[model samples]
Target: MRTPLPKDKCVAAAPLCQSDGEIAIIAEFLPRRIELTRADPGCISFEVKPTGDPRVWDVCECFQDAGSFELHQGRVASSEWGRATAGITRSYSVAGL
Candidate 1:
């Protein structure tokens, strides 16, 4: 089920599962992505943290609204960070879309 969120607030929270080989790529690229994402005007909050499992990262991001989230998606899709993680597995739960 979708999490409860106001219509004007968008959120994505979940785990990013990485393979042994993908871990290096994520580590190399995620920092810059986090920097850029947090700088976005519509970003409310963003976080990515490593879990007890080395291969999993907990990701939680909130945007001002659906429009903001869509814009973020577009930006990421064309970004180098997006390309690097394109093949990585992600289990995300998003609401307010």
Candidate 2:
């Protein structure tokens, strides 16, 4: 995603992405992360949906812009919360990223 210029403000749309995968744990782990990510700056929307298969999950995320998405990734990579939480979960994509 790229920032739109003043003149390009009328362009198509913003950056919205989604992912589908399975997490290793549920308990309070996944919900807690969702709460924190939703409160993050530039996060337009962040949520996870169960696909009824118990092990299947769908995640949707919308950011204010590209910068926000990058920031979120950074936090996920370096934050203590991220490290601890990540250690308990295994995200299986099966195919895509």
Candidate 3:
């Protein structure tokens, strides 16, 4: 279910959409990356989808809020997960939801 944005103070500083993420990983590392992402609590929903070309895979993640999103970002960047799968194109637009 699509969750409504919380009107509480926790979300006051957060963007309207909270978070939107898109990641493109080299296919070989996708399984590991997906594993890492789905393990994060902040990720309200996570999905790994195929690209037409077998060489690429796309990741979609939606976090509960900005804080959750930030937490996930830091975790991914600092953990073995990030180091293990570092490469290819990662495009994220998180500002203003």
List RMSD in Å for every model shown.
Answer: 4.9, 8.9, 9.4
- Candidates in order, TM-scores: namely 0.82, 0.57, 0.58
Top candidate by TM-score: 1
lDDT per residue for candidate 2 within 1-82, as digits (tens), equals 5543232221121112122222444433666767877887877666577665665456666666667666877876675546
Where's the lowest-lDDT run of ten residues in candidate 2?
Answer: 8-17
Q: Which of 1 and 3 is ahead in lDDT?
A: 1
Write the residue-wise lDDT of candidate 1 on 1-97 in tens digits: 2243454444654435556778888889989999999987677788887889887877878877667777998998899988988888777688766
Who wins the lDDT comparison?
A: 1
Q: Over all chains combined, what TM-score does candidate 3 have?
A: 0.58
- Once fitted onto the true fold, the runs of candidate 2 whose alpha carbons sit more than 4 angstroms away are 1-24, 84-97
Alpha-carbon lDDT, every model: 0.76, 0.53, 0.52
Residue lDDT tens for model 3, 1-97: 3342343312111111111222332434557766877787666566666667444444556666666667878887886656744543444434323
- In candidate 2, which residue pairs get closer than 3 Å at backbone N, Cα or C atoms, i.e. clash? none
